[model samples]
Each structure stands twice: as structure tokens, then as C-alpha cells.
Target chain A: MDFQLTDEQRALQETARKYAREVIRPKAAYYDETAQFPLDLIEKGFELGLLNLAVPAEYGGLGLSHLDGVIATEELAWGCAGVATSMIANDLALLPILIGGTDEQKRRFVTPFTKELKFASFGLTEPGAGSDVAGMSTTLRREGDHYVLNGQKQFITNGEHASQYTVFATTDRSKRHKGITCVVIEGRPKGMTVGKHENKMGQRASNTVTLTFEDVRVPVENRIGEEGEGFRIAMETLDNSRPLTAIVATGIARAAMEHAIDYAKQRQQFGRPIAEFQGIQFMLADMGMQIQAARLLTYQSAWMLDQGQKNTLVSSYAKSFAADMAMKVTTDAVQVFGGYGYMKEYPVEKLMRDAKLIQIYEGTSQVQRIVIARELLR
Target chain B: MKILVTAKRVEDPESKIKVKPDGTGIVQEGLKYKINPFDEIAVEEGLRLVAKHGGEVVVVSIGGKEVHEQLRHALAMGAHKAVWVNHTGPLDQMGVAGLLQKVVEKEKPDLVILGKQSIDDDQNQVGQYLAEWLGWGQATFASKAESFDSENEKNKVPALVVGADNKTVRVVREVDGGLATVECQLPAVVTTDLRLNQPRYASLPGIMKAKSKPIEELIPAGLGVDVTPKLTVTKMSAPPARKAGIKVPDVATLVEKLKTEAKVI
Candidate 1:
């Protein structure tokens, strides 16, 4: 298969990169320092059709190829991972509709946001469950034509500002993983409460807040799929989202490399630019090499998705490898910076901090390894 | 009615271009190319016209094989079809305009739209030349276009073109001082500026569909026109770099420097 991006994919990548460098980068530090959401950046991404890259064209969204989505994600993450996480979460929220929603559901829930700049959140991880989908305790009980959901979801990206959410809750507690079901919850619905924003160490520009559902009533038609299919739906969602995460990791790594390369050329040590030193040169080479490999894997996984191939294994591989590579590359980038890397004044420190979350969330590094191992064993 | 929209692939509008070591053009290595900013507006206007007036919007371009990429982009932006006239060597404004005129004669589109000027050259001369060759109405620097039934003929719908007004097409041109609304007739060419519609992103399905849409290539002979350069570039050079200026301690010192040293204030 050809690895070259189609013209549209290339254009989307360029647009995203332009937005990242010109708009997002300038405001990143301020958002990080103040722990505030980058609303302007988010709006700009919406305007550029970067916010909801997955919502179908039928729903008024740009409906980019999975590969295009990954490219855009990488570019946005390059600018600011926190902001990227917050913005890209809209895709995660809309994945259920893309995968299983009826035509009416897509129009009502997905189309409105595409007409404007709106944020969405995916509610899967509860206070007690991070990587354990079967362990979720939220419940959606049917009552008449509606379902009343009572649960608490934590660590939700864009939780505070999202207009809608894709919330998963157990419909039948006896069936474990099979008992879970997904539903759409309006942000301002009755009995829905948004908690205080979490003060994250990195990606501070993204708001991670806890959402409390107290008898939150949602239309029964809002169930994403048939009963007992929540686990499968969730896995499928990750199958699409994992590549996006890998893209974000790739962006972080690229940003680190760029910053390190520029720093090496400008910052002088011992009567010469540090970039002239073989030690630093090797480090830069290694970073570039790993970043390239990660990008290829990430794009390949996205391409597989576009081709309608089963990409669970490949996506897991990309997510695990790219996230780990990002962490290492950013850390090494800090090393390239030496003392300056430790200071916030330099951008590498921020890149280092931002790179950490890619390995933690969207199926932690350990979880990704588990998936890869399971697939390989199979 | 059939319409033709011309677009160019240039350095991304947001990017700051640096002149190449060879003085002929800007450095393109590692730079991203996009539909020329003004051309995007023109494409959007074409699509809007088609959507409202009910017609097909075809995009035409004259460049290297890479022009197909921009053609596909226009198609994904909702153009009905694409025609790319491939040129191996660079063409001056007059030569490119000649090629476009040939395509216009072949397609016989009711209207032609293009960017007021390409970002790279900024010559702003191709549309005028093509309009003159076609002997059709020309409207330059159009920000909007609307079609309504002419008051004189209640039964006939007249396209309310907005930008430049000439012998035929009435356009509302943005002058150095203010805006001037002028009327023009059909079979006209309209060039766009920045204030036109914000072009929509090509949706994934649109991109996929564009791959299937026919993009016919016409060589100079295929269009029954001889392709020859009308203008030659003997030499090219880079603009001189800005000289370093002294930095002041604060706003007051900068004001003093501007007033006394530079003598501008």
C-alpha cells in the first residue's frame, strides 16, 4: 500500500500545523501557567475543521480520513498536548455515533456541533475504573421512554466545557463486561453536575473534571448500540481513537526534536554550538529516528482503519510504541537542553511534561502492552 | 449553466516564505502547499453560486502534474469536475492566461472565477488578460456575488456580481479608499480577494469522491492552442534583508528614537 498522504490528507496536515504554530503555540504557555482552557485555540481548531475530525460529512463535520485525523492530531499535539487532548476528545465522544448511531442520532447529536465550535467529552473511566471497563459502576436504568443514569465519571477531558458527553454505564450488573451500555448525556441536563477541574501536572491547558450523574434522564433511543454491547462498542471506539493518541505522541516527539535541534544550534557551550558535539548529535539522530518510526506506525494504523481493516493489534502496537517513544524522546530532549531543560522558560520541559500523559491515558502503556500481547498470543 | 474556477497551489497562506538561494523563486523545500488563499475564496464563491443558482462548477488550472492535487482539492470543495493543463516549465502571467483562455473557449462556461492574484508572484494580471482575450465581462477583487431577477426584465434572472464593474459585469470593487458597487453581465470573469467566503474543508467523503471524479488533462494541442511563453525572466534576485536597528530600553526611548534618530514621528 502507498504510504504517501493523499492531497486532502496533506492539506489537512498543513492546515493543522499552521494552526498549531501560529495560533496554539503562542497561547500555550499562558494556558499552562494559568491552568485555563485554551478556548481561542479550540475555536480556531473548530474553524479549521480540526476539532471533530471524525464526525461524518453527513453530520456537517469535516469527516477526515482516519489518517487525516491522526495527522491533524499530531500537528495539534505539537503545539500543545493539553490543548490537543481537550480538543481531540470531541472525536472520542462522537465515535459512538459514527460507529453505531442511527441517521437521526447523527443529525441531532453530531451535526449541530459541526455547524459551530463546540466541545464534547467521553465519559468511560470512573473513580474506581481506569483501565478496567468491566469494573465500571455507573448504571442506566430504563424508565418509560427514557433511561435514568446515576454514576460518576472522572478524569474526563474537556469535561467542564463540553456541551455533550458519551457516557457508559452498566445496564445489567450480572453480566460484567457484557452488562455495560453507552448513552449520550447532554451537559446541562438535570441532575448532572460538573466537578472541580483537576490540576494536572502537564497538559494543564486541558480541563479534566469529574462528572456526577444523579438521576440524569436520557432518551432511551440514545443507547449507542444494543444492550450488552457496551464493551465491544468501547473497544471499537478505542480502536479508532488509539491511532489519534499515537498521532499526538508523534507530535510531542517531533516538537521535542525541533526544540532540541534549534537549541543545540543556538546555545553555545565550550566555544562552540552544542549541536556540534557528537554526544548531542547522536541524541538528535536517535530522536529523529524514533520519531520517524513512530510516525510511520501511527499513519499505517490510521490507514488500516481507513481501509476497513481490523487494526486492533496494529493500533495497540502504535499506541504503545509511539507513546513510549515520545516519553523517551522528550526526556532525552531535556537532556539535550542540559540545565535549561529543567526550567519552564525553555519549551522542552513543557514538552517533557506533556509527553507523559500520552503514555498514561488512552489505554496506558501497560494496557497497550496487554492488548498487543493478547493479539500476538491469539 | 457551467462555471470555471481557477486555483493555484502556493506556499500556505500562514507560512512566512523565504526566498530561495537561487534568486528565481521562493524556497519550496520542506514547505507545505495549499490552495492559494484568494483562490480558496474564489472556489467557495463558485460553489456557493452553484449551490444557489443550480449549475455545475468546474475548476481549471495550468501548472505541473502537481496541479492535479489542487484540482482534486477544488473538487473536494464541491466542484463538479476538474481540468488540469499541465506545464513543465514556469509560465508568465500572459502565458498562463492564454492557457486559461483556451480552456474557457473549450468549456464555454457561463462564468469564470479566479483569485485576484496568486500569493507567490502577486502579479494580479492573469484574470485581466484572460478576460480581455475572451472579450467577456471582467470583475476583479470580488468579495461577494448574488443573483436576482433584473428589475428591467422581471422574467430574466441576472447574476448580481460584486467586485469590479466593467463593460458587462457589474462588480463592487474594494478601492484604496472605499467600496464601489458596479454592475456587470454574464459570460464574465471575477477575481476574488481575502474577504470572500471562508472556504470549507474538504470532507473525508468529498476527498474520496474527488478521486473518482473525472480530471481530464488537455495538452496544448489537445485544446487546439499553441503553448508558448509570452514573457521571459532573464534574471531574478532576492529582496534585500532589513538592516538591523538599534533597540531602545522602553517605550519612551523607542518613541525618542523614532522621533529623533529615524525622524519618522
Candidate 2:
């Protein structure tokens, strides 16, 4: 089978690579250190048509294929995982609109955000819900033409800065998964409060904050799907997003591997380059192999998405494999650094920290395993 | 009033180019090509002028087969139509200028826009040659553009006034020291610089619509233009790589090194 990227795909990849090298790479460390959002870079991303890749042509989006999105995401992550995370969070927030929102909703909410480079957040995880999305306790009760929302969401990327949110809440408490419903909440609506930012170990450039909904009112038209379809919507959104997370992981791992390889050649030990050592060479080889494998799996899952195939199994496989590989590769990169790896002066430590989150967010490695098992068992 | 913008496909601005071993030209294999950066500004300026004035914008390019990408890019930037004059191999500045003259004669547009120079050659001669061929007013290295009334044509009135009263274009050009602004009447050739308006990224719909925009092709012979190179390259070679210098502990040491070791300061 031909493995080379098509001309269009290669062009997108080259564009992303140029952006990563010129813009994102320069600001990554500063944003991580200060926990400041890279708003300027986000604007640049919008200018380059990197932000809303999957939104259709009719809505003024690039309508890039899923594989194209994955390729772009990987390159961005290679520059700065945190910045990449913050930028791609819009994809997650816009998924519900792409999947189920009405034309009016799409025009009002989705189009503005994508067209104007407005940041967005997805609110599914809560104070009580982490991996268990069904355990979310947020509620939306219908009252006349509006729905009153209650409860809080935590650890939301771009939560503090997003102009809009796609929030999941319970419409019927009696039924577990069937009770969940999705709503599009405006960021500055009455009774909505953005809590203090979460100080994380890495990916700090990405703003993770808690969102409190104390009787926040949303229009009934803002409901994404049927009353009990929140669970399905959330799952389908994850099905699209898991590959994205994998792409991010692949990016981080690729960066780490590239840094390690470069270091091995330049770093001298025992009057010779460390790359000459079998141990270091072996580490580099394994890192390269894992990154390539992870990239292939991630692209395959994205290709499956573009082809309209059932990607539940492939996405789970990619997410788990790439996330776990990123963690391993970054850790190995640190090992290659020896004493320098432990200090914040070196970037591998930061990479290690950034790689950790990929395994935790979207769907945890455990959750990915469960999905894979379910698919294989069937 | 119709405006024609000339475009050239060059190596992608972001790509690093290497010269061929034969010392004649740049190595073309595996290199990415894109709409010339300066030409993009020219296209954007043309579109903006057309948008402000009630007129049509058309893009014209003379190159090999790969030049169609640049034509499509102009179309995506809101140009109404495009024309491509295909040449099999590389064309020098004179050949390109001759072909462009043919296109200008065929289109008979009121205004012609082009980049000050293509990035690959950096000759900065095509616009002047085209202006000479067309016997039109010429403005080079424009940073900003405005339409105003021509002082000489104050007493004359056209049948239709689409934009300003006299159809005069005010242009800002970068000179040796700073910027100079000049006004020229219609039927002029204006070359663009980077300070011109930033070209808009083609939206998905615009790109799709550009596929259907009419693109007419013409050969040099068909256009009655002699396409022959007026200049020959003597040699080509890569610039030497900058050497990495030793790092000092602080600025004081660096200053000391610069003063003592380098001896230039």
C-alpha cells in the first residue's frame, strides 16, 4: 500500500510545521511558565485556517478531512502541547453543533466561533464526573422557552476564555444514561460563574477552570438533541475527539523523540557521542518506532472517520497506544538527559508533564481499554 | 473599469531552496511551489480596489504548467476570472514581460498590477518592461493605494463614473529612505510591496467556487509574442552557512570579545 501523504495533505502538514517552528515553538515555554493563554498565536492559527478544520465549506470553515486535522494537530503539538490543546479545544466544543445543532444554532453559535476565531469549551466532566460521563450530575430543567441549568463542571480546557460552551446535564434523573441532555450555554449568561484557573503541572498554557451554573438559563432551542440523547451525543463527540487526543499525543511523542535524537548526536560522553552507545541508540530506535506506529494508528483512525466507517475500535486503539507511547517516550527522553532531565531548565521535563495529561483526559487509558474490549468482544 | 493582476508561482516562501549543481538554476526536485508572496499582495490589492470600485478583477500569469495554481489562488482571492500563458520551460524576465504584454493587449484592462519582483529571481524588471510595452503609466513598489481625481483630467468626464471622479490611483511606494506617494491616471501598471493589505486565506467555499471560474489558456506564438530569454545565468551557488559562535557568560564579556577579538567595533 502507498504510505505517502497526498499533495494536499503534505501541503497542510508543511504549513502546520512552518507555523509550529516559527510561532508556536518560540512561545511554548513562556506560556507554560506563566500559564498565559496564547491569544495572539490562536489568532495566527485562525488566519492560517488551522483552527476550525472540520466545519463544512458552507459554514466558512476549511472542511479539512479528519486525517488532515490529525496531521495539523500533531505538528502543532510538536511545537507546544499546551498551546495545541487550547487551540483544538474548539473542535470539541463545536462537535455538538456539527453533530446535532439546528441550522439557526449552527449559524448563531458555531459559525461565529469558527469564523471569528472565538475560543470555545466543552463542559462534560464535572466536579463529580471524571471518566464516568454518565455520573455527571448537572441538571437542565425546562421552564417555558428557557431551560434552567444547575451544577458545576470542572477541569474544562479554555473554560475561562471560551465565548460559548457545550454543556451536558441531566434532563431526567430517574434514568441513568438516558437522562443526560446537552445544552449550548453562553459564557456570560446570568448565573454562570467562571471559577479560578487550575494550576496544572504542564499544558498550563491551556486554561483549565471550573464552571459553576447556579440556575443559568439557556433557551430550549439551545438543547443539542432530544431530551435523552445527551449520552449518545457525548459518546459520539468522544468518538470524534479521541482521535484528536491521540494526534496530540503523537505530536508530543514526536517532539520528544526528535529532541532526544538530536541530543544523542550532539551530547558527548566518554570522548564520543552518546548516539554511538548501544543503549542510547536502542532508546532512540524504540522511541522512533513507537512514534511512527502511533502516528500510523492515529492517521488510520482519522482516515476511518473521513471514510464514514465505524471508527469506535480504531479510535480507542489509537488513543490508548499513542497516549501511553507519549508518556513512555517523554520519560525516556528525560532518561536520555540524565541529571539535566530533572530540572525545569530542560524541556524534556515539561514534555513529560504535558504527555501525562493525554493519558488522563478525553478518555482515560482504562476507558480506552474498555472500549477496545467491547469492540473486540463483539 | 477592469483591473488585471499578474501573478507568478515561485518556491514557497517558507521552504529552503538549494541551487542546482550545474550552476544555472535552483534545484526544482521535491521543492514546494506556491503563489509568490509579493504577487499575493498584488492580487489582494487588486481585489480590494475592485471591491471599493465597481469593476471586475482578473488574474493573468505566464509560466509553465504549474502556474495554474497561482491562477487558482488569484481566483480564490475574489478575482472574477483568470488567464494563463503556458511555457514549457523557465522563462526569463523579458519573455514573461512579452507574454504579459500579449495578455494586456487581449484583455485591454484599465489597470494592471504585479509584484515588484518575483522572489526567485529578485530582478524587479518585469513591471517596468510590461509598462514600456503597453505605453501606460507605471508605479512600482506600492505600499498603499487610493483612487482620486486626476488633476490633468479635471475638465474631462467619462461616460460612467464607477469609483472616483477622474479614475486616478494614488499609490505609496517605498524608496531609498522612506515612502513616497504619487498619483497616476487609469491604464497604468502598479507593482506591489509587502505593506499592501494582507491577502485573505481562501475559505472552503471560495476555493470550491474557484474551480468553476473560467481560465483561458494561450501559447506565446498564438499571442504573437516572441518568448526568448534576454539574460543567461553565469553561475549558481549556495550562500555559506553562518558559523556558530562561542557563547559568553554575560553581555559584558560579549562586548569585551567584540571589542578585542573581532576588532571591528
Candidate 3:
């Protein structure tokens, strides 16, 4: 079992880590405070070819391996999960098009993304359908050459910023999941109105808002896969994207753990460094253990998918394990920091807040467990 | 006009170095290497000049086979081609200047651009020595990016090629007190400073294409120069630790201590 990263992968990792230190990490706090999207950094990511690394070369992307994307994402997330989330969410939107879109459709939808740092949302979840995809209330009605889209999507990331959206809507609610269709909305279709921006506890650098679509006209050609195929497309896209969430969780875990350890080494209590205490040491040890396991699981899932192996089970494991691990590790990190960690002045609190969302988004830890259990039953 | 830029791969500036137990040298077990920052600027400057004056940019490096990676990086930064001069042991500034002098003779580029100094060895001597060996005028420690007329030879001068290709260029260099601007004829060496220009990241497609670019490796022994070290480091050690300070009880006591004990008023 050769586990060593290839030289090219190592180069990708180094480049990203360097960028994280030099660019992202320094501005992380500022962006988080102002809740401003880092457009320049996003442009820089495009220049560095960090955006759309997995998309094919013909479509103006690097055609990099899935492992390379995971490595890059982890390094960036190490800097700041909010900025990293905003960055990776761009790739999240592209995965569906790359997976299920026809060549002509890819040319129409994904090619423009390669040239710029424009964002796109993965629009499966609505106000009513977070975990239950079949329960999504958004509807699409056929009108000759176009489908009229109407829906209310809540907690949608990059709602006001994305030039396009990979939105899912049911053609027939009676048919449930079988009636779902995935459609690409280009440049914010005329009838779509972006609603109020939501102020979240963490990952604030990302723009999260409500999207209101009123009879938005989308051409039939923009549909990804056949009608009723949206459910599978969404599932497969999540399967491809779940590892990214795990990588982000691992990043938050590592970042918080690192700050806690550094603080511990220097912070003195009772005439000795807090790190000298076995209790603090044990917390650090557990933090380290959790991060390593999450990272390993995340890497294994990404690698399996890259090798064209089935990854539903491992992907769920990574997402579930990493989400829970990040929460525990970050909370412990705050514990290691004492009262200072509870304050906003310290970074551990922010990490703790960010770690909570990982357990809730993409797929919750419970949802992931359900998938894992299904695999076991199968 | 043909522009020649020198590329040097140095240990990553961020990595910490520790003297060996025997006090010989720092551990090189897992050192990360990258194109020195100044050299990256030089390569970028060379690319910019070539872009403005329609010429081929050739990047050259004197190192072992491993330096090919850096050379490819230079090519990826948009250099037209690259040359690798192989050497095994450490060489003094003069030795490196002499080897580069051989490259100058063969390539005979209209202009030679190099970093003011390598970060690994902060000796700012190669650019001067190289120009002297080639009997060409040089401008060292060039001022930051600014565009001024060549007529103001005492102020900031941008390294801009005027009429004939990259033949006649102007540069303003950092001087003892202020700045000195120089307008040198063709075949002159210009050592770039930190502020010349920010180096562009090598694009993915460019890097992929850089792999196929020709890199002609030459043996330094055939150049007929002694590539021997003329300097020695008797020992190596880190800087001394900084001492802690104590707080004074009052301003009068602090003043008294500063005047009598610390000897500063």
C-alpha cells in the first residue's frame, strides 16, 4: 500500500499551503468580521488554478485529480473555513454539470466558470427540504422550449453572488423523487429575486441568503440529465462533494488544535505552562488523534473516487466521522484555551462555531450514519 | 533583442534551519527548495522587458540536476527557453560569476538580468562581479517600480527599454544616501531589487507546457574554470538568545537605571 503523495500532488499542496499562509490566513479575521466575500482572493485562486482543478482541460480547467483538489481544499481550509467554503462551493456547483451534463451542456454551463472566479450554488435544499430531497417544494412546469421555475430556497450560499445556479425542482410532486429535474440557471434568470442575507454564527465570509424564484424561465437544453434523474444526479454530486466537507472539517479541527497547542505551550498557570499539565496534554493528544483520523478518512474517500471505486460508504464515513470529530476537537481546543477561548478575541471560538455547521450541512452526521447503515445492510 | 535572466533555487525562506550537532552545517534532510524571491522578480522583469520589446527570454541557472525544477518554473513563468550549467560543490561568488560569464559569452544576450543577491547567501556581489567580468556596466539594488526619464540619473528610473529593442535601458538603483539612476547601453547586467515587480504565479497550462521545453545541461568542467570554494565557515551557530527585562517601580527609578546601570539617558 503506497500512501505517499505523488510529486505533482506535493507541489499542489505546497503551492496551496503557501498561498494560505501568505494570503488567506492573514485576512481571515477581517473578512469574518466584515462578512465580506474575498473577491480578490477568489480571483487569485483562479489565477493559481485552484478553482475547478478537477474539471476537464477541454472545458478550460486544469483537469487535476480529485486527490489534488482535496489536498488544495484542506490547505486553504486550514487558513479559514469561511473563505475556504466560499472557494470550494464554486467547485461544488460544477461537479453536477461535470457529472451528468452532456458535452454540449458542459460547454454551455461549465466552460464560462473556468475563465473567471464566478460562483454558482448547488440548489437542491429548500426551506422545507434540508435532508429530505424528495420533500423539496420547488416546482418546474414545462412551457414549450423552457421550464418555468418557482421556488423558495433558504440558507443558499452565494445566492446574491453566483452568476449561475444548479437548481433542482420537481416536475410532479405526486411522483416525488422520480419527478425531480436538475436545471442550470445562467446569470440569475430574470424572474429570480435574491432574498435577505442570513447572518450565520460561522463561515460568515460566505454569503448565505434566501433565493426566491417566481416563474423563472430556463431553457430545456439546460437540464442536466433527463427529467426524474435529478435525484440521482444530486446524490452522486453529494457523493463527489462529501469528501470536500470532510476536508474542511479536518481543516477547522487542525487550525483550532494548532492554536490551542501554541497557546498551551506559552500560557502559564500555577508557575508552569498549561501544557505541562497532563490534562491539557491529554486534550491536545485527543485533538491530534481526531484530526489524523479525519484527515485519513477524508483522503481515503477522495482517493477511492479518483480510482473510480464506489465511495458511498467511505464518503459517508469520512463526512460523518469528520463532522463529529471537528466538533469535539474544536470544543476541546476551546477548553485548552480556558476563558480566553470563549471570547471573540481568540480564534478558537470562531473555529468552534464553524465546526457546528459541518455537522449540519452537505449531510448531517445522522444522515451520513443512515447511509453507512444502508451500506452495511446491503 | 535577446534577454537573459539568471535563476537560482534556494532553500525555502520560511523553513527553520538548525546547526548540526557537530557544528558543521544545518540539516538538509527535508529542506524545501524554491526559486529565490529576487530571482523570481528578475525573471518577471525579463519577461516584461521581452514582452515590451519583442525578444526571446532565456533563463540560465548554475546548479546540479535538481535545479531543473526551478528552471522549468522559470520557463513556466513565460521564459522562452532555459540552460542548466551543472556543478557539484559549493562555489564562491567569483566562481559563480565566472561560470555565468561563460554563459554570457555563449548566449551573448543583449541584456542580463539577475537578482541583487541570493537570500540563502545574502552576499550582494554576483551582479557586480558578473558585469565586471563581461566589461559591461551594471546597476545594482535597483529602486522599486517607478517610471522616470533616463535624464534624471540621480532619481528613480524604471527599467524600460526605449528605442532599439532592449539595447538601451534605464534603471534607478539604491545608493548610499539616496538613489542613483543609470542609463546603460546593451549587454549590461541589471540586478533586480525586491520592489521591481511582484512575480506572477506560474499558470497550470504554462507549467504543463514547461515540461516539454528544451533544457540544455552543460558540464562546468568543460568551461575551463576552477569551480572551487575560496571561503570557509569555521563554525555554525544560531543567534544568541535575547535577554529578559525587569520593570522599574517608578519613573525616577527607571531614569536612574537608564542613566547609571543601562548607561543611557
* Candidate number with the higher TM-score (2 or 3): 3
Best model per TM-score: 3
What is the C-alpha lDDT profile of model 1 across A272-358, one tens digit per residue? Answer: 999999999999999999999999998889899999999999999999999999999999999999998999998999988899998
Shift in Å, residue A268, candidate 1: 3.0
What lDDT does each candidate get?
0.84, 0.85, 0.86
Ranking by DockQ: 3, 1, 2
Q: Is candidate 1 or candidate 3 better by lDDT?
A: 3
Best by lDDT: 3
Off by over 4 Å in 2: A1-26, A43-50, A57-64, A100-120, A139-150, A171-175, A186-192, A214-222, A254-289, A329-349, B13-16, B19-26, B51-56, B141-185, B192-212, B228-265
The global Cα lDDT (0 to 1) of model 2 is: 0.85
Give the alpha carbon lDDT tens digit for every residue of B139-219 in model 1.
788753322224543443322442333224556666676666766677888888766556776754466678789998888
TM-score of each model, in listed order = 0.77, 0.80, 0.91
Better of 2 and 3 by lDDT: 3
Which window of ten consecutive residues has the lowest lDDT sum in model 3 chain A? A6-15
The 10-residue segment with the lowest total lDDT in model 2 chain A: A6-15
A152-248: candidate 3 lDDT, tens digit per residue:
8888878789988999999999999999999999887788999867888899888898888999999999999999999999999999999999999
lDDT of 2 at A172: 78
